[model samples]
Target: MKDNIIDARGRACPEPVLLTKKGVEASPNGVKVLVDNVTARENIKRFAKNSGYEVKVEENGEGILLTLSR
Candidate 1:
């Protein structure tokens, strides 16, 4: 696991979103969040966008990779 990477693959709903919030807070430059489900990906994407960040999404094996940056 990387310091700027949040692995929320096995988690669900609010947990993934919450982890992403924290990750973004801690990483001033950017944050990379990993989630295995669509819900988490969408939720995090919306949250990041609402919070004034740019989200870059991509497929990561069996999961999704969301990269948030200001």
Candidate 2:
């Protein structure tokens, strides 16, 4: 089930959000955004929500996963 994961770990601010935007635009189905920090998680979550997508957060040894779906 893991697919199109945008790894934004160690990235700051707009970078994560920009990557997410590009991912979303590229994939109409949805995407999984992976972030290491809470700030990145929150920013990506907000960006996903504003783009009219549902956000599901998951924590794992790898990092924080922000799953975005239509």
Candidate number with greatest lDDT: 2
Which window of ten consecutive residues has the lowest lDDT sum in model 1? 1-10
lDDT on C-alpha atoms for all candidate structures? 0.88, 0.90
Looking at model 1, residue 8 earns an lDDT score of 96
Q: Residue 59: error of model 2 in Å? A: 0.5
**Clash count for each candidate, listed in order shown:** 0, 0
C-alpha TM-score for every candidate: 0.90, 0.93
Candidate 1 lDDT, tens digit per residue, 1-70? 2448889999969999999888877886679998999999999999999999899999958689998988
Candidate 1 runs further than 4 Å off? 1-3
- Model 2, C-alpha of 62: deviation from truth (Å): 0.7
Candidate 2 residue-wise lDDT, 1-70, digit = tens: 3399989998989899999999988996699998999999888888888889999999999999999999
